[model samples]
Target chain A: MTERPDQSPLTSPRSERVRKAAALTGRSARRKQGRFRVEGPQAVRSLLTHRADLALEVFLTVRARADHPELASLAAEAGAPLREVDEQILRAMVRDSGDGGGDQGGADASPGAAVGGALVSPQGAIALATFSAEDPAAALGAVRALPADGPVTVVVLHEVRDPGNVGTMIRTADAAGADLVLLTRTSADPYSPKAVRASVGSLFHLPVLTGAEIDALLPALAAADVTAAATSGYADSDLFDTALPARLAWILGNEAHGLDEATLAAAPLTVRIPLAGHAESLNVHTAATVCLFETLRRRRLEA
Target chain B: MTERPDQSPLTSPRSERVRKAAALTGRSARRKQGRFRVEGPQAVRSLLTHRADLALEVFLTVRARADHPELASLAAEAGAPLREVDEQILRAMVRDSGDGGGDQGGADASPGAAVGGALVSPQGAIALATFSAEDPAAALGAVRALPADGPVTVVVLHEVRDPGNVGTMIRTADAAGADLVLLTRTSADPYSPKAVRASVGSLFHLPVLTGAEIDALLPALAAADVTAAATSGYADSDLFDTALPARLAWILGNEAHGLDEATLAAAPLTVRIPLAGHAESLNVHTAATVCLFETLRRRRLEA
Candidate 1:
C-alpha cells in the first residue's frame, strides 16, 4: 500500500482538468462520460473496500493522508494513483456549497462556505469512479429474484425534481431498509453532486435505479406484489391511519405539484400527512423522510 | 389605488442604487439604513395586508404591475412610489443573471450587463418596508409571556449554521405549531434572502428570536419549565423511546460537531435518532423534523 499524496495546491494543469471534470459529475454528465466524483477519506476507503472493480482515481492533500492513514493504505493496496493538490483548487472543484451561501447572522461564514471549507480542510481528497448504469428492467428483475429473506420495501420517486430531495429520499430509503429505489424521467439526477452530498455517503450504499419510464415501472411493481401508495395534500386518509402493506412501494411527488394524474391513477391508495399548523406543505425531502419512516415503523410493529 | 410602476428593467442609475441597497438588508444593516428587501407578489401582498407599522418602499416591474392589478392598487393604497424599468434592466438590477444581472439560471450574461434584448416576464412584484432593529429579548419575552393554551414547544438551534436548514426549521416550527424559534449566536440569520425563500413565506408568520447567547439561554429555559433535549450520536437513549417532557426545547447542533460539551451538559436529557442502516447521520433539517414531529406525536397522544 502506498502513502496518500499531499494535495495542497492546484499547481498541476492535469489536476485542474480533473477538478473541472468533476463538475459534470451530475447524472446526465455521468451518463455521457461514465464517471462520478467521491470525496472524503471515509468515502474513498468505502469505495476501495466495495467497488474495487470500478476504475478509481485518487486526489489527496498531505494533511488528509496524514490524518487518515487507513485511507492512504487502502488506496495503495488497491493500486489507485493518489495525487496531491492545493486546498484552494479542491475547494473550487466542489460544485454547490450545500447551504447556498446564505448569511448566518454573522456568527460564522455561510453554511455552504463552512461545509466547503470543512471538505477542503482535510488538506484535499477526492476520487473519480466508474459506475455501471443498470437497466431498469434488469434492476426490477433482480428485485423480483431476491430470496425470501430479502427486503420487501421499495421506494418510487415520481417527478420529484429537487436533487437534494432525491438524495435525501435515497438516504432515508436506505435507512428504512428499503430493497430498491426507482426514479422517473422528470425526477432529479440521483448522482448529482448536490444529491450525493445531501445523502451523506448513503448513495454509495443504496441500490438506486433511475430514468425508468413510469409505464414500464407499474407492471414490474405489480408483478412483485408491491402495493403502490401515493402521498397527497387533500387525501382524507392520513398516513398514520393507513394499513401499510407488507410489500410496499411509496410514491413521492414534486415540490409544487404532487403526483401527476397517471401515477395517482396507478396507485391503489393515496395517503396524506396530517398538517396541524399553518404551513401548507412539508418540504419535499422532509415529506419523503416522514413517509419512509412511517412505513418502517409500521412494518416493525407488524413484525 | 393608483397604478404601481414597473421596475423590471433597471436602466436608471437610481434603480441600480435600490437593488444594491436591498442586498445589504441584514438586521444590522436594516437597523442602520432602515431598509429591507421583500420579494415575490404574495409576500408583498402580505406586507400590505398586515399594514405592519413600519416605513414602506415599493420597487416593482412594469410587467409585474400589469399582471397583478391588486398589487398596483395596494402600492397606491399605501402611498408608496413605484419605479418602472425595462425587463432586461429589471433583471440586471436583480442580479439574477450575473453579479448585477437580473437573469436567474440559464443566462450567460455577466453581472451588470445592459438589458438590450432581454426577455421581460415580470409577473407582479414590489420591495417594500423598512424595519427597525427588533430587540431579541423583548420578542422572545413576549412569546414566552403569552398565556399557554397548550404545552409550549420551542425550537432552539444551537449552531445550525445552514441558512436553508435554519429557514426550514422555522417553517417547520411554524407548521408544527411551535410557540417560538430561538436561534443562538452561531445560527443562521433568520431573515437572510435564501432563508426567507426556504421558509416559503413562513418567516413573516413565525416569531423568531435570534442572537441568544447560549450561556444565557440555559437558565431561562430551566426557569420556564422547559426541558432542554440535546440530540447527539453518543447518547444511548433513543429519541422515540424517551419520556418526553410537556414543555420542551429542542437543541440541535452543527452538521459536524453536534452540540458542544457545554450545551450537552446543560441539556436535561440527551436523545438519539437510532440508525440501523449505512447512513452516518440524518441531515440536520431532517433530524429536526423527526424530533419535532416525535414531540408533536407524543403531545397529541397525551392530550
Candidate 2:
C-alpha cells in the first residue's frame, strides 16, 4: 500500500492518480478497480484505526494534517502511504461522486455536492480502501459461530436505494450494538462515498455483507437460528409492546415500496412503530434507529 | 390570492409567475414576498388540509391532477386557484433553488438537486403559501391553555443548520405527539423548500415557531411551567433512567457545535441517550426521535 513519498504535495486535480480516485465515485469504476474511497476525517480516521489492512492510501490537505496531527502516525502504523494534497484536489475527489445513481450531478457540480449535501465542506481528508465484498453465507457462518451468551441483532436492508439512508442505518445499527448488517443485492452500495460519509466510519465497525437475496437470506437466517422480524406500517404488533426474539434479524423495506407481501408474510414477526400523531410513517432511518434501540433497551432491562 | 383561471396550461418555465415562484427558493425573495414554496404531493396535501388559509396557489402538471384527483376538490375548498403546468415548469421551479445558504447551487443544477437529493423526481405538484411565522410566546401560551394532558412535550432546536434535519425533527415531533417545536434564530428555516420536502407534510401537523433566543426561551419555558431538558453527549442522566416532568421541552443543539455551556447550565434538566455501541453520537433527528419517543413510551406505560 505504500507509495514513493515525494516531499512536494500533490496539487493538481487533473493528475492521473487524482482522476483515478475521483472515478471511484461511480459504481463501475469501483467495481472494476476493487477499491472505494472514504471521505471526511471521521471516516478516514476510522479506516486507519479499524481496517488498516484494507487502507490503500491516505490523502490530506496540509491544513488537515495540522488539525489532526495524529493522522500521520496512524497512517504510518497502518502501512498506508500518506500524501499531502491541496484543498482543490480534495474537492475534485468528491466533486463528481455520483449520488449512488439517484440523480446525475452536473458536469460543473461543486465539491461534495454529489453527496446529497450530507457533506458541505471538505473535512480535509480522504482515503482509499480495497473493496472486500463479504459473502452473506460466509458472514452468517461467522455470526452463527459466535458465543450464545446474549442475543445477537442483525439489521437487514431490503432493496433500500438511498446511500445516505443505508449509511445512516449502518451507523445506527452499530450504535445500537447490532452484530451485522446484511443488504439485499438491490440495496444501495454500502461502500459508496455517500454511504461511507453518512456512516461516520461505522462501515468499518461491523461486518456489512451486501448482495443478499431475501429468498436466500430468510432460509439462511433459519439455518442460523435467527428469528426474522420485519417492520411494516400495517403490522398488528406494536414495536413497544412486542417481545423480540433473542436472536433477531430486523428487516427494513425499501424507501418507496416497502417489503413485498410474500416477504412480509414470511417473516416470523412484523411490528409497527406506533405513531401518536398524524404522520403516515417514520423515515426509514428513524424507524430503523427506533427499532434497533428498542431492542437494545429491552436487552438492557433484561440484564 | 387567487390568480385568474386560465384554461391553457403553463408551458413556459420562464413566465413571470414561474420566475417569482422559483425565487421563493431563496431567502431574500421569500422574505420579500412573504411566501414559501412547498414541493411534492405529500407536503402540498398537508398544507391544503391543515393550513389551507395560508395556501396562495396550487400548481400541478396535467398528469398530477389526474393522479391525485382529490387535490382539485381540496384546492377548491381551500379557495386557492389550481393552475395546470408542464413537467418543465415543475422542474424549473425546483432547479436553482438555493440550499438554504448552506452551499450555492449552480445555474445548471438539475431539478430537486437543491434539496440535498431529498426529492428525486418532482412529485408533479408544488404550492405557494403565505409564510405564517408563529410566535413562540403565543405558541407557548397555546400549549399552556391545553388541558392537563398526560404530558406536554415540546422539541426545541438550537442553531441547528440543516433544513432536512429541522424538517425531519418537525415530522418526528408530530409523530411522537409533541405539542410544538421551537427553533432558535440561527436554525434553518422550516419553510425552506428542503425542509418542507423533508417534513413530509408534518410541518402542517404541528406548530413550529422559529426565531427564538435561548436566553428568552428558558425564562418563557420556566414561566410556562415547562421543564427545559437539553440533550448532551456528556450528560450524566440517562434518558431511560430520568423521570421527566409533565410539561417538558427537549432542547437539541447544532450539528457541529452542541449547546453552549450557558444554555446547558441554564436548562432545568440534562439527559443523554445511552448509546450501547461505539458511535460518538446519534444523528440529531435520530436523537430527537429517541428522546421524544421515550417520553411517549413512559407516558403510555403510565396510562
Among these predictions, the greatest TM-score belongs to 2
Model 1: residues >4 Å from true position, as ranges?
Answer: A1-11, A14-20, A26-29, A76-81, A84-123, A146-151, B1-17, B25-28, B45-55, B58-93, B96-123, B130-136, B146-149
lDDT (10s digit) by residue, model 2, range A1-303: 324434565778887677777777677667777888888788888888888888988998999999998889999999988988888888888766444333222321345644433446558998888876646666566556655656889899997877778888998999889988888878878887667877888898887888777888887787778889988888889999998888898999887778888999999999988898888888888888888888888888887
Model 2 misplaced regions, further than 4 Å: A1-11, A97-109, A114-119, A134-136, A146-149, B1-11, B97-109, B114-119, B134-150
Q: Encode model 2's per-residue lDDT on B1-303: one tens digit a residue.
A: 334434565778887767777776666667777888888787889999998988988988889999998888999999988988788888888765444333222321345553432346568998888865646565555546645645688898997877778888899999898988888878877887767877899999987787777787888778778899988878899888899898899999877678889999999899988887777888777788888888888878877
lDDT tens readout by residue for model 1, B15-66: 6464454443344444455555555676666556544443265556777777
- Categorize the docking of model 1: acceptable
Give the number of the best model, judged by DockQ. Answer: 2
User: Local error of candidate 1 at B211, Å?
Assistant: 1.8
RMSD of each: 6.6, 3.2
Query: Which of the CAPRI classes, incorrect, acceptable, medium or high, describes model 2?
Result: acceptable
Give the local distance difference test score of model 2: 0.78
